[model samples]
Target: MTSAQNIVVFEHDKHYFTEEQKRLKLDEVLENYYGDYSPFFKLIRNGVKFNQYVGVLKVGNTTIEVLPKADGNDKDTWRQLLIDMIKTVWGFEIKVSSSADLKLKSNSILDLYFELYTKELEYLLHRGLIKRYNKKEGNLYALKGALQFSKHLSQNLVHHERFYVKYSNYDVNHKIHCILYKALKLINKTNNKPDLNSRIGALLLNFPEMGDIKITESTFDNIVYDRKNHHYEKALQIARLLLLNYYPDVSQGRNNVLALMFDMNRLWEQFVYVVLKRELRVTDFKVKSQVSKEFWRSEAGTKSRMKPDIVLESRNNTIVLDTKWKNLYDNGPSSEDLRQMYAYHHYYKATKTALIYPGEEGKMIKGKYSPIEGNANASDNTCGIAFISTHTDIVIWKKNIISFIKENFFHVIEEG
Candidate 1:
């Protein structure tokens, strides 16, 4: 629709609004719909007639439709790029789905997830391998059990990778089956999708049902991925990811939308850390994430901490860098970010410090990644530091990060 009322905006593109109607809607998202996504919308500046940034922002009832960045041969969609970063950076922030299956009918993240989840389960079904894990439980209803108690415990006895028996609460397949059940319940409560809900609900019953499983770190701690346990792990992960996206029933409200949103800030940090690990692949250089520097000691002991996003340490030198997902514009980084970076340099005795942000070429003054940009807050007032950028291109962006480290910090020495 070419009508002003029906206009849709996409992530990472500029939208110039000549009408006050659209600006009001953008502000509504900023004020009202800003749930856990406050930081993301902050990246979208509400200018006089233009609001622009990366990522989707829903206005009223519709999710902002992102304009295609390229036409032909650039089939790498935004979701693919997003998933690529997620896989490389966190490695565990995904479920099973092919590239074709990841494309969305709508701009909504929730819609995309439901599609992926549905497809993944379907794939598992077609392969005939969406099996459950066998776990033993006690029962007295069936006298043929593992062990019968002194008569009070009727259901506290049973045993193996058993099948076709009564639902075992301890079984992982049963646990995962229950997770899907619980997620389906949550999804039903929302007005997000009705037909899809019906489809998922009907399909869910096809699998075995069990009592709700309390998912915890310990729930999966003992699990080891092997040939036998692979299917269960994949399904369990899908269930776990879905389970994490909702709040407890007590916290739910009338206006709050049950949407699953991931923080891109942490994603960017992890992405940089992963890429830098590649650049510093030499034997001498060691790259660590969240390397803590304890600068304060009290009765509590080592309470104050300086944990930068990345720490690159050689035998002689240490360099610290922090990743900011924000677009710094002409103003560069905030003073608070600089202050933290300065503290890192002071406490860790870091030879270099950098505030790395998402890069759009020609947007800001490109500075050398080297330490030649003298730190204003240096202990000696002479150490080197600079602001760096991580490009948006998937292939080149990673290489850019790797090269940025190699060219700026890594020192080569010739042996005798």
Candidate 2:
């Protein structure tokens, strides 16, 4: 009997050509040798031999064969064709090996062939025959491996972290290292600041699945310990999430200017949700999607249609708030954003209108305005407008927002 292993190897080695090349070679062979055999004959023919074997000359290996073209009838025909083609073209000598007997029957040669090819490709990638372009450059700078030319398969299984650890020591780039360091920091935040050893192990163990690449625990651990990997952008995103979730308070007040910006936006929303529920005595507060139609309309349409981020309504008073992510302390509202907010107040018929922005260093704005009180109409005064700025630090911003709402809107609700 023919052993399954030998059959698989034979099939794999046969169809070594890529899909495009295989198609071209088969077309040429059919036109030249078999004269494009009749559909019936084409279907039945097992495999064709290529006129020339380019790989064999370069590699100096014999036993490569290019099988005749198949009409797609039997499965074995395709496998046999590939094996024959590889032998003829690449000239790699291959001897069929069997455990029990030299000649046994197998169920499906195509399946066996695919299995063998998967294993081979995986081995090549792991052995660095197919490697990342440069660990420091991340995915942007990847180059094709030698084997890549032979097989035009994409290196989708490659991850930035894996590439860094594998090739970091060979060449060190400072900028790339900083990125990798930040990425590790974010991952650590995700894992509750576990030791470096533990974090590295987790990353390796989480290898994305590919054709047949198996990740062992030890392999993962070794990659982590290797210490050369660096990827910055990925680290920054992860760190951002960690800062938002784990240490919201610390992130809000961090000396890092960007950190302040991020914290302010998050806390501003949170405070709005809390105050609307607690002070306004309303429980139905919800996070509105930023992609509302009103938000995207042209300036004129948006001024007429935009919904405020927060809407609080009672028997006598209705309050609408538009949250601004910009620095409100240093720079006041753009005429455009403020005008839009005013429109929301008017259109919604709300008694109170506020444009909220991130407060700057030692500056906070809390006051009411009425276009009617000046030369504007009394209707505009009925819709009081205010500009409120809250600190960028998450904890402080949250407190300031709540306090501002209480002093402004809550008092009105009580007085009424």
Candidate 3:
């Protein structure tokens, strides 16, 4: 087996391979994964171009980390930035010790998540695995709950010492454990780090073995959570993320792929919304994300809706904000984005609307909409192009964003 290779590519960047690198067949594996699962990357002539989606992908022995870079930061900085953004946006709490080896040696975003899952499982194992009552059908020496007459007659006819019985066996084998076990097995297959693999192996050994299960979209649909098993919530969430995104090569089992990707556009929008909501928590104004309003309806009762990324509403005014994750260095907003803001102003009755993007210093532009052709009155609504610098720490960036919003929309809170 060849040694594992770790490659890092920035967002929207293309990577062409050397002759030695081409033999890894990562392109073929990515193409297969794209066909079978998500089309996150575009396959060019001997290379792959990552789009707005940024995350980690593992194909056999190679780990590719696609990171988003808005400013002139290195891949490692952007990698940590992406991790921090995801942890903040998705509410993932990494509970490992400060000096843990996994924390020190996590090179990829996937490794961070894997380490989180492992630590979560470690905590659960320390607390003690919970036992649940499960319906099991097996050949038991003594009849317990119910007896299957047809199967018992056919099977027990030859061996009179056993009985085919169906009973409630209260043990550690349950759906939650099954999902965790499946995730552990997947990690064991996908991970190559020795330290993390050792922890995963220990977790697998300590955790009770569970029956193999076919995980589908509806696998966790019916899960009920309460105080008794409330601790498993975090572990199960990470497990779901691991188990669902994995696409196994059923044909040869050689190119098993696991992709953990998130759209940068959606992530940027959510990050802005969450930060705004958190900043405005103690204020009179309330922040909402994807505030939808039906703009059109068809004859067949089909409806079309318009959603603005962030909406700040008080008793008097509303401000709509749309976040774009691209850099707009000395450039103007697109006509499509401007039209979308115009629609938001008309529909949401927003007094002010703006398009937010990652930018250099002093890149804010302000403009007003012209009145209708025949109308004598000019519209009072206004739109803005605001940019937040990403070269600083996230905490400073968040504070600057909130300051810019409150300063520009000061009238809303003042009037309230």
Candidate 4:
């Protein structure tokens, strides 16, 4: 017997309300007319029943009912529905408002829903309903439906040798589609419970197949064919499957050797970047090799060029940072890596030179000679040569980098 109403009030008046006021009003309406945020259904003595669907909201005498076209139980379905609503409301509001309208209200209802969804998902993942598996270590965890999609894709890549042979002449798109189709079939047969590592292996196996496949008319046709008729959706679907389902748990103290190698370089680079940006006020920094080619020469020989992972340049200082993914405490810097970074520092005339490596070891400024016992000998100190070690984890590395930059680079700048 409850009816929904659409009431269009003066946009100016609604826009005038503060965020706090709007929130208070929304809470009041929900408490009085609509059921609170909970999953339940209740029947009253009168012909009125309270539905615990969080999508429904009430304001004054009007009830805003968002009808979800897809299965609400499916997480993806709910996500897509919320996204569609947000886009619709945003487009409508933009179209209705004049260019002169300064007080246009932007709603965070969709963001709130997403936040709630994320919290629940995180809880589920932590509680072990949805588990993460490592592709490199060959760890298999049971996940059903879309959660297992990535695992299946990976397995198809590694196990299917004939897939490469079959799609030899096909374009990249076609080859990828062929692999995806095979993988999906394999996954579907298992009723969603499949080995995550095997799926990742499958995807990797197909990469070599598509390496030589040209992107041409055949490729476009293949994409259309696969998207419209095949079991899998898109190339990104394959990627998502790997990222979501088979994301190797790197938190186990780098137990997976492959994961350590895979994540180390990326984490090291990010750490150096964060540090340089925060400390030196050097926002314009780039990664890997390409600087002013005209100004620099290769350090290895007459032919081989040396490339630093991070290059930060400001008006006052130029910093050349070389990030080694290896654990400095264990491996230390090889003569080749040190030579490469030294070449970069010397060639670039970088005011500061950092050989950044992965570990929790403290900063080591180049003394008269090497100080860490059997550690690699320090080449010089005037160029501000330093060895900075940080944790391998991306989050910890980021924090360390920022702190290092603030203390070293920023302090120097401020002092100067």
Report lDDT (CA) for all predictions: 0.53, 0.37, 0.81, 0.38
Question: Which candidate's lDDT is highest?
Answer: 3
lDDT, model 2, position 70: 14
Ranking the candidates on lDDT from highest down gives 3, 1, 4, 2
Q: lDDT tens string, model 2, 1-20?
A: 01111111221123333354
- Least accurate 10 contiguous residues by lDDT in model 2: 53-62
Deviation of model 3 at 289, angstroms? 1.6
lDDT measured at residue 335 in model 2 versus the true structure, 0 to 100: 74
Query: Compared to the true structure, candidate 4 yields what TM-score?
Result: 0.35
- Stretch of 10 with least lDDT, candidate 3: 93-102
Q: Give each model a TM-score.
A: 0.61, 0.32, 0.92, 0.35
Show model 2 residue runs off by greater than 4 Å. 1-194, 200-305, 328-332, 360-396
On the 0 to 100 scale, the lDDT of residue 300 in model 1 is 66
Which tens-of-lDDT digit does each residue in 1-416 have in candidate 4?
Answer: 12323322210111123344344343333333325432222323321232322232323323333322211134334333343333332232232212333221222232232222222222322333211221222223423222344545666566543121111122224454334334333222221123333533443443233223333334444443332333223232322332222222234321111000113254335535544444443444433344643443478645544556676665566667666554444455676765565566557866666676544454745413233456544334333334453332334535665666556665444443
| Evaluation by TM-score, superior candidate among 2 and 3 | 3
| Model 1 TM-score, 2 decimals | 0.61
Tell me which residue pairs clash in candidate 3: none
What are the per-residue Cα lDDT tens digits for candidate 1 across 147-167?
Answer: 434432333335322222233
Clashes of each: 9, 38, 0, 17
Candidate 2 vs 3: which has more lDDT: 3
Instruction: Give the better candidate number (3 or 4) by lDDT.
Output: 3
Which regions in candidate 4 have their CA more than 4 angstroms from the true location?
Answer: 1-267, 270-303, 329-332, 367-394, 412-416
